[model samples]
Target chain A: MKEIAEKVVAGDVRTVARLIRDIDDGMPHVRDALKRLFPHTGRAYVIGITGAPGVGKSTLVDQMISHLRKNGKTVGVLAVDPTSPFSGGAILGDRVRMQRHSMDEGVFIRSLATRGHFGGLTQSTRSAIDVLDAMGKDYILVETVGVGQDEVDVVRSAHTTLIIVIPGMGDDIQAIKAGILEVGDIFVINKADRDGTDKTMSDLRLMIDMDQKKYKDGKWKPPILKTQAVFDQGVKELMDTIEEHRLYNFKTHGDLPFRKRKDRVGQELAEMVKARLIEEVIGGLVESGAFDMVVEEIVSGKLDPYTACERIVIPVLGKRP
Target chain B: MVQKRRLRVMVAKPGLDGHDRGARIIARAFRDAGFEVVYTGLHQTPEQIVDAAIQEDVDLIGLSSLAGAHRYLFPRVVEILRERKAEDIMVCGGGIVPEADIPVMKKAGLKEIFTPGTTLDSIVAWVNANVKPR
Candidate 1:
């Protein structure tokens, strides 16, 4: 485990990918490997790109990868694809779009299926990013499985989020998807060569103006830029704007948010407690048949869950008045 | 020794083979049979397939070719995997290959060849019995 963690931190692609797979599978070795990797993380800048299906998110990400590479920055990409509801499998197509960098030594790209995990990512998306961070990537790009109004979960996990839109797609509604609007640190109007480009930009400009609260909290004003990702136009400015945001974020937020840091600790603690209570503590008692007695009463309609809670839950709680 | 782990398979089409029915059916079959299948979209080069196999850490690669380039394409994949020291990843082939060429391709290291009438169940069973996990 220590050797695997050391190889991952040394940027071995095979070991990094293996550790991420282990984490996603919840294998026992992941905890030890991650504990060894923890000291090397928090270095990479995580950028998230999200948009409705067919908004050219992958194309834009491809351009961003090229731009970042031209500046000599090592980049890692986590491309998420939706699981097919019927097959429980995914066609991870984003890597296909970014195939130009497939053999680039400085670039590492991993494709993930949403796999029934919420927020358009696998449940271990955070762990995957942490492994890539430990692998010494200068920038980590997380492209979500495609976004609906409520698919802002992956964006919330990133330090910077880009909400992409295309012309003639009723660009107004997408700009204000309630959830994405809160998380979008930058908005890109991709496919700017198409018609209705002016309308899309105008609608977004007005919407951004109306979102005063987005600016009032000493929050950075989200920039709306246009690009034809296929032609690689305006991508340099996108890269420049991203660098500006990074510098600005460092000056303002300073590494990490104290409140979010505290919330992360609290959340992890709650999850650990919940797992122990459900899997180890209550689980053992349930196996002892105390749970079956309550279940049998419920099955016979002799006890309600509320009363069952009173009778069976008190003993599990260990102490009560 | 057999180990308890999900088999990761890459069902890829190398070269300009536009016919994907065989690959798609096999990929879906593997998925339904409880394997993790990564299907590379069409027009993948041999290098790309090998690269994907390594990045995905797949145990098996099911190469589908109808373009008759499997004679050329399939061996290139096996060679690259060997170059990358990933030769433990088993390779299989499906699609429109002449039966006469099957022996030569297998000699070049394709572990199995599935023709038009091959059943998905047979392929799944073969993989379950043959897949190596550590």
Candidate 2:
């Protein structure tokens, strides 16, 4: 594990890829390598791009890779696609769009399948990001599985989240919906050569105005940009805007955006705790037959779920909350 | 939680082949067979395919070429993988190759070749029987 972690930190592509695969497979002993890699993370800036399907997210990401590489920054991309629920498999076609960067040693593109995970990302996305970060990438671009409202977990993982929409997609209404609108650090109207480009841009500007009314002084406003990703138009300006946002974040939140980093680490800790508790406590009960007894009692209407929970907890905690 | 090891395959359309109907079909078939399939779209160079296969840590690569470049493109992919020390990634070829070139391709390190009319099931079954996640 130490050797693997060392190789990953030294930017060995094969070792990093294998570690990420192990994370995706949920293989045991991966946590040891991740633990060793933890302190080496937080060096890369994580940017997330998300939008509905067919909104040109992958095309935009491809352009972004080119722009970033031109600026002499090493990049790591994690492009996710949804898994097939019926077959437990996925056609990770995002790489199809970014194949131009396949031979570029400065860029590493990885495709991830959601593997039954919701929230527009796979369960291993965070760990994969860390692996990339520890590999010494200057920038990490996480392109979520084309997302809708409420599949906004990308906000928690990315320092800058770009919400992409094409013109004439009724995405203005989607932008007004609860979950996705509030999470954008930048709004991009890709495929801007299409007809409804001005309408979508104006609509996004109006929404941004309304959303900005509640912000305090020095808060970052999500800028709306227009781009024809297929034609590579406006992509350089988008890269400039992203760099501007990165600098703004540094000025507002110190060198590393301490608050956001703390929040992300806190969330990671909470998830780990929840998983560990379920595995240790609940798994123990299920193994000892107590959980089965409670389930049978509840199914037969002899016990209520709230009381059953209390009964189960009292034995474990020796008191009721 | 112990998750089952899953196979990762790259279905690449190598060379200047503009026809990708067979590649797309086989990619979907692999997905339906419960393997993660990474589809490299039209006109991939051997270097691009080998780089992607290494970066993805794919267990196998299915090279498709309908433009009659399999004799060169297919073996070139295997040769590059061998040079990169990633020859553990199994290489297979499909589409428009003549029967006479099969021996040369095999000699160059292609593990299997699926010509026209090969059933999708048989290909998937062959991958299942031959490749294991490393």
List ranges where model 1 is wrong by over 4 Å: A117-123, A146-151, A171-176, A255-321, B1-4, B132-134
Docking class of 1: acceptable
Model 2: residues >4 Å from true position, as ranges?
A: A117-123, A146-151, A257-260, A275-321
Worst window of 10 by summed lDDT in candidate 2 chain B: B1-10
lDDT of 1 by residue, A1-321 (tens): 889988998888888877767765546567788878878888888899988778888888999999999889999998877766776655666776887787888998887766643221323677788899899999999998445532466556677888888889784456456556767788899989999889988877877888787688677998999999999998888988988888887888676842246665575446445543454444555658777887898999999988877765677777663
User: Would you list the clashing residue pairs of candidate 2?
Assistant: none
Q: How well does candidate 2 match the true structure in TM-score terms?
A: 0.90
Cα error, residue B131 of model 2, in Å, equals: 1.1
TM-score of each model, in listed order: 0.85, 0.90
Q: For model 2, how does the per-residue alpha-carbon lDDT over A177-272 read when each residue is reduced to its tens digit?
A: 556778788889998989998988888888778866666687888889999899999998898899899888888778764324677668766766
Clash count list over all predictions: 0, 0
In angstroms, the error of model 2 at B65 is: 1.2
Model 2 residue A304 distance off true place after TM-score fit, in angstroms: 8.7
